[model samples]
Target: MSETTALSSLKIEEVPQKLQIKNYFDLKKYPFEHEALFKREKVTSVIGILNEIEPYAKDWLKNKITSAQKSAYKPEASVISEGSYNVILENGAVFKPAAIIGFSGSKDTHTIYIRKGASVIGANIYLNQGDIYVGEGTVIEPGTAIKGPVILGKNNEIRQGAYFRGNIIIGNNCVIKGELKNVLMMNDCQFPHTCYVGDSVLGYCTHFGNQATSANFGIMGGIISKTITLKIDDKNYDLNRNKIGIIMGDYAQVGCNAVSDPGTFLLPYTIVYSLVRIPKGIYGPNVILKNKSFEKGITEVASLKI
Candidate 1:
């Protein structure tokens, strides 16, 4: 087989208009209505948008929590309030409010909004100096521990042993069973089984199979930290941020045990096969990436001199 066939299986379906966030993501089908927060005209680049929206997104999330806290319309479900902690339950969703702890020891209030048809049974919610919003029909199973300052959209299944750090925004119908922090996940994305995703943006219908990881940091720290750069079509673009993960586009897939290096970016419909280590760069839309060693005829029996 040819070398090109062993590496990338499919050709690009369509080229993007620009290297902007809008070109990669399907904003029309994005579950969250926070496009204004992206400041599209101000920061068109994908990494630029993420850097520009970090503080704004946190503020927006806090505002949402505050608004929900002051809501006058009583839900038909159970609401338990004690001191600065409030747990709102709907559709028989059950969890011990005491398990939700104020880990930061701050004076700020903590609110958990579990909407209708959602459940958080036996899950531990850590009020890590922020609030949590669980949308309708989401299920957070036992052994899952979630740190607050998150907005989870409708119908997500957060399975057992899943761990979530703060500052995350998730869209509808996702299957999350991983360790996540500071990320935005769009509609229908899946990270089923143990995985690690941090400081990233996952687009619509993306999937990360079991044990898939996005390495977000440089190996060597201090004054001489490695800069994250993305090379696409012979052009090198440096992302100024110190830490970055993957900026996966819509319909992308990372196979089981696959790992993406820092500053990796996948265009729409890109599929990375299992056990592959994707380098720090920009990849394609409608393409299949695989290791050459995985080819069927590559293995040959040879005697070792040792």
Candidate 2:
């Protein structure tokens, strides 16, 4: 089929009703709580709203950061830093043998902000690249590297070996030990162990087992389709984006070592079995997704309670 013909065949509204972002996430929860930008009625896509809000959010945060810089204090003896940064010691923050580098080898001058009661601990923990804001009482453990344009909420536990590439916004009380890039994680989510989550949005209390991966690109690359297209019920919905990972709903859980293809969407409370290679599409609100093998795709599903 001609490219235009194939593209014309795809429609956005054809996306299943169950796959709607509202079904998986509730904006009343963390990160977006009390935000007027999200509460507006006309904006339907949470993903789109998230992107739209980024610049404004960053500016708001930057203003606060600049204000806070007036009271910034020097780091302790063990801490090493370069370029420009600030550490606010309102409730007592700590950095144990950490290095903060504020330049990204370019014109952009990255700034690091460690809020009150936060801790960056490690033999060689590194924070660099773009602007970084670590929330109150958050603990970043050993061997973790956080590149910036990242915002984290209160009391998050970022364990050892965690590597955050960039463009991440995480809410309060998340437990993370993985590689993340361009992702938004709502409150109380747990990605406990090594995993790769890129270009994704994870809803409240979502959990990813060890080694779980949200693949964000097509294996075929740009050779065929430039953007990711989701097929639902044999109909195509062109997302018009090249790098979309999983869009998980509230309380969703993906088992250990499972892989979710690009543009995967899981509704609330969905549970995926271990070792399953979930096909790129929408699935359940309360169901168990199981696969006999990666090549076989999803072969079985059962109703789940909670």
Candidate 3:
């Protein structure tokens, strides 16, 4: 497809500056072609095409407000008792130790007290001194380290030897394994391998292939910053979190060994094929590669027009 043809089909009035970063990535080095396409196609039609490949995009956005609310809600201090410990940082902030840990095996006997509705395989599962809250129906494989103040939702499978850190919130039906450092995940996500997921928030149903990782700092070990602007209720807003890794929308798949640079924001349903390096941007649903002419791939399946 010619650039002009692709541009004529998309219907965007103007490409937001934040969404224009796709030009910097190797896969999408052509900006003028993408911008022109944006003018031709309507956003709804484009979203429809992406939805076919990633059905969970709309669901993820729909639940954002609820997730935000849950994050904002604070548990009462009075509700915490002696068996439940609190870790107070030097900044004077307090965190409940139990909410952050998950244990399995004979370790349960060592637990001073298990919180209400906390699940375990049996008394055979041991729990260290960390504060851990095992959500209803959550399962911890043998030999998993249950850190303090870890809040896990229902039906999570924490694999063996998985090391968890505090300030982590895992939503329902997620699978985690192999050295999950401080991270927060929404519902239905999976990190099922030896991947290092540290200081990140994963949207619902987002899947990470084996060894897919994201960097949080620059070469000098200094913090990296990137600006992200999203349209909310037709108004654009900026999320100013410096330590951000990647804000992937629902049903977005990160291929194996793919390394997303720090602060990468992938729109809903975008798929990164294996070994592909995506520069920052709002990548349209599909892309076509032809004889040095890169164009938007057809949204419809089996549309022989391309």
Candidate 4:
């Protein structure tokens, strides 16, 4: 089938009544194209928006960078830059940023945009291929390797050993210490410590404990389709996407070492206990899900999407 014909056959929706979920999943500021986890309905929406504004943003950023390189950008005393990416130094600041230490990029595939008050403290941190855009007042610590097409908003903490691949968007005042690819984190969210958040979308102030993970793809896999379903109780909601991971709503918290099954969708203020293996379904807005490990579950990380 043709692409348009195939997309016309797909529809994504949320089933709140299945898990008895009510007043969960807000729609207001959602479907932001920069975000990774969004309703399948937003797919076409993003394409249209990107077609309009992406070129403009690129051109504007390029010209601004060129001007900054020629006239205004002044490297701080602590920096050890390779001089590959352009730097924009906003003047009249009280304090300057720390050393850029080490950074890498793909050939014309990405650019690194760092706003003022952004700091990269310590060593072994590298920004590799693709564009990495850090908004104002963000801090990145040591041992992290970030690839581009990632957008980080203001006042965030990109802590140690944080690994990122392409297509991730993080909002303001957030913390990310996990391994993420194609993930979207709303404002005030935290992914502190060892975790894998792939193809997921986390809402405001949602946080994960150490070692929390999202199992994104099929385990017994052959050909993985992006269309999947969310089963809550006897009801099934067609997600219309094959590679859906965790879609967590606002104020949700997962305890240490929690492993969510593929396509786990939790609503606002939901809490899952430590070492729990979350089932594949949509959960409540104000519920507490306590769980214990079965020990019979096989390790599923080997089948993860790259």
lDDT of each: 0.73, 0.73, 0.46, 0.61
Look at candidate 4 and give me any clashing residue pairs.
225-242, 226-241, 226-242, 227-241, 227-242
TM-score for all predictions?
Answer: 0.80, 0.83, 0.50, 0.69
| Full candidate order by lDDT, most accurate first | 2, 1, 4, 3
Candidate 3 Cα deviation (angstroms), residue 12: 22
**Model 3, position 62: C-alpha lDDT score:** 27
True lDDT of residue 15, candidate 2:
33
- Whole-structure CA lDDT of model 1: 0.73
lDDT winner between 1 and 2, please give it: 2
Q: Which stretches of candidate 4 lie over 4 Å from their true place?
A: 1-84, 91-109, 122-129, 222-227, 232-238, 292-306
Order the numbered candidates by TM-score, best leading.
2, 1, 4, 3
For model 2, the superposed segments whose C-alpha errors exceed 4 Å read 1-19, 29-31, 34-43, 49-57, 72-80, 104-108, 123-128, 222-225, 293-295
Who wins the lDDT comparison? 2
Cα distance off (Å), candidate 3, residue 219: 2.0
What TM value does model 4 have? 0.69
lDDT of 3 by residue, 202-235 (tens): 5557777888776654443455444433353344
RMSD of each candidate relative to the true structure: 8.9, 3.8, 14.7, 7.8
lDDT of 2 by residue, 104-127 (tens): 455645456677899877724334
Provide the lowest-lDDT 10-residue window in model 2.
2-11
